[model samples]
Target: MAKDFAAMEDSNRSSNPSIHDVSDPARRTVLRGGLGLAVTGLLAPLGAGTLAGCATAGGTAPPLLGFKGVPVSTADAVTVPEGYVTQVIAAWGEPVGVAGAMPAFRFDAGNTAAEQALQLGMHHDGLHYYPLDGSRRGLLVMNHEYTDDGLLHPDGMKTWGAEKVRKAQAAHGVSVIEIEWKDGRWQQVRPSRHARRITAATPCAFSGPAAGHALLRTAADPAGRIVLGTLNNCASGKTPWGTYLTCEENFAFYFKGPERPDAHQRRWGLRPGDPVGYRWHEFDERFDASKHPNEPNRFGWVVEIDPLDPTMTPVKRTALGRAAHEGATVATTKDGRAVVYMGEDARFEYIYKFVTRDRIRPGGFAANHELLDHGTLYVARFDADGSGRWLPLVHGQGPLTAAAGFADQGEVLVKTRQASDLLGATKMDRPEWIDVDRDGWVYCTLTNNSSRGGAGQPAVDAANPRANNTMGHIIRWKEDGDFDGTTFRWNHFVLAGDPANDRADAKGNVNGDAFACPDGLWVDARGVLWIQTDMSTSAMGKGDLARLGNNQMLAADPKSGEVRRFLVGPVGCEITGATATPDGRTMFINIQHPGETPSERSDPDQPRRISNWPDFRADGRPRSATVVIRKADGGVIGT
Candidate 1:
């Protein structure tokens, strides 16, 4: 999730042992050995073959990276290697091409709420491309993390009304668009039947153990079986049975509560005033916690959508144990059971994993409807000696009994953070996104936690060894046996910062390129680990972070620990979400919140002061869009 809307409060008040507090902290400082195998012969890479329904293929030791690394860039444009080209396919406010109403994006920001519904939502984040005709045509499903009202209306927040609130709400959710390769470039198919927008008002079903719990029940949804919409959708994942996993992060920021919230609300970061000043509660009663107390509980779960089937209602899989989920990455066990690894994007949080009780059947998505529901969710605890344990969050187990505030499985899953707190899960430095490599190793991005080692905050630990960690690092772990195993060994992949910095804490151990705040992550064919960074908008091109330039994407060799800059985004934007064709020739990535000012919002009268990307029209407001990249010589990307 972007820091602009993240929950600012440190809610975990637990005394669970930090990795440094465990035995032998000094021995745990060094990263573990190189990821075992060479990247060349890995069986199933993350993109194309693993995602686009194509037969997985590999060579007998192909080079991990073949392109020349681009230098650090501060320019207000997309920068790629010399042999590659990029095109803007989908952007915020553009028509999603739904039938009967395809509203074009208004450069002056005069689009109404009704028109915004028919168009693409704002701030494209995590996305996946599902092939329809062998990558030539596919459904590009992406998440719209949040909306910037300053750019949504012509006059911005100068005036407030219900209609303006509705427009802002309309711009928060997910977009599924049909895209195809035409005339050597990717394009959105107009009036596409597959085009659909799931917004904050869209109806969604709740499934899994915590579905109908009293905490999730509200006046509008008394049965607790339905939720109005899924907002704050950040990073994403795809299921083995062909479904999209859109995660809800920073949902706590939307609600406006009383002067004093209850324990449950406080635990979830709900406070007295509107910390984010979203002001949605003034227009929509549902956003008022004083009115609809349980409405906030309805969100913060991973939603499963079948992008290929628009008729199907998206389901909020409750069994995944919610906690401001950054994203869910799925891997299968030796016997076909699904193992899901998720990260909660907040300070002092814990990593979670879910293992289904039943094996995935022969049939497609329908046959696995209940697979995610009947799983055992576990939180990770990284020990000082490089070992870790997955503590099960089951009712009546360990400290999660009736005496500890959990009465049943539903309560255990609903209060997941409290449950993990009682089980002594290791406190981490803002776990963001989790992905599994072909070698069965799980990697997660720990975006910097400025509060670490500060006064009245958790001190620097072995797993998170920096005080006021400005530049973040990546943590990787390999399970003892399969993805569903109860134990694993973990280590840091790289500490991200400039090696020449005067401050020792800010100088990272990066091998090739110096980058900060690693966020989005993916492993492509030939086992190249792609990393995307999201430096805070206020800090980019300033202070020690200035030398790093704008937010960029880099390719890393897992075997040799070499990182190379692949692409640098426009000013004030985040380079996130990566996908590629089945042939590995074409690739897709999202540029989010371009022209974002230091305040994280643009001034309506002077919006173009920061950036004017993709379409630099005089009246244009910076728009978040998806960029398509392919090699000029018609060869595999990065090769």
Candidate 2:
């Protein structure tokens, strides 16, 4: 479930499913029944005072640095507009999981759950910062989607050895860290109640319609009473009532299923499709597609966790349905309903939104927890003319008719792919991240998919128009009347890649496009779209166009369609996991797998420093840390 952009573009595996990768089981474009998410993979200070109204004349505001939409020079470090500084917060191996400080990290030594519990997990992805009661301190919850087998074990991990495999398992899961700003530097509060880790060994429960469905039943969970753990957590969100929502991505590879059952050979579920990729079955019998046809049903759903209270077991809210759930971003509706926008993350998959029934009572814990349980889940059906509609997935609703084979709510959730198919939701080119700006516009990143369905593959439509979409794009739309409704207006904002490349502007979408593999996404307080890239070509050391080498984080002025690359990661790295302080004076961005390449990567202190990052840190370890960017005056960021 974990791979860099190179695997996304080059490897046939569905890790990222560039265009053609979707149609086959081995490929990512297809959804893994119950597996985990293909855990996925940025910075910059924003400028001055709520520069009320549009960007001042020169893309800059009075008394503040004008944006000018000018591109930053390609350098080997982080960049900020002006008067801003960034600091590293944590790295992959720094202590956190245990009761006290972590021992010197041994890439080769054996670390048990107790030892690993104190250290940070691998491939840090989406995160949440929960302000603590009466204190400037907050809880930082992060997802360690998967492990870097080579980096975790002394010798590369061999699946055959339970000891090595356990270490690898110990590395997979979530890490909750306690962080507070002291003397202006964010430091960990060692021995704090807020710091903790949740791994594959952690027990979790399933909720919603499919909680006890037949597909989820396993030998370990004969009655489907429990799910052992949550794997490959990618993008995530925070509940209005203060819980954290972490998603499971690329979950299929974890299980070693048997052969493809007769049903699979006929036609795969909901995935637009995949033709080739990893033969995970070769590794373990659990991966056998035939024996556990229903195994995949257990995963690929949005999970909810309460970080403040670490012991408050996490849950998979299947009410949101399952697919390659990129992540869910929750917002309130005009009527006070909690609306969560989610992306399926597979080419041809659908974009969905779940509007809760109970109104979020703002700071109302009891109300918010119940808000997600009951909601109307809708899929997007966009038209070529830019107008769109939401197709309902309610049991027995418009498209959830008996003819579709989804006669009950559980079926709708377990077979979300089929439910969406019946609704005819607009097919996309690998939609990955979804966010809602304060302005109410919904933005999504359709990460690159080299295969445009093909002769039989879905063609480029208005919503997704590009045959071989090597240069991915970000698209946005406003709900009808600028409200989150059933219908909306849409437009392609930016096409990605080298500005000089002719194909970059294939559909006039490249106006502000300067990077590829637009994966992780978020909207700042200023309405500026923050985009981070996952470039496989760069990770592989191939040609520059595909291998820009340095994946960057860009800020886009949506109204003007202007964009800029404000930060670039180290060698062999992809920028990801970004969040801004409420004050906007400081912003936190994650640098994951700095040097993780398709062939190999370097260790923490030795050979092939695959990536030399978080360089600005006072400590020279160059670990993957959360970089906090702040303006000197502590003024609002990105005016």
Which numbered prediction scores highest in lDDT against the true structure?
Answer: 1
Which runs of model 2 end up more than 4 angstroms from their true locations?
A: 1-82, 97-104, 107-110, 133-135, 158-160, 262-293, 362-364, 481-484, 504-513, 538-549, 598-609, 614-623
lDDT of all predictions, in order shown? 0.84, 0.64
lDDT of 1 at 528: 79
Q: Quote the positional error of residue 322 for candidate 1 in Å.
A: 1.1
Cα lDDT tens digits, model 2, 327-366, are 7888877776788999877656778888786677866454
User: Can you write out model 1's per-residue Cα lDDT over 74-174, one digit (the tens) per residue?
Assistant: 88899999999999979999999888899888898899999998889999998998999987999999999988877888888888899988898889889
Candidate 1 pairs with clashing backbones: none
Return the TM-score for each candidate structure: 0.95, 0.83
Question: Cα RMSD for candidate 2?
Answer: 7.9
Error of 2 at 418 (Å): 1.8
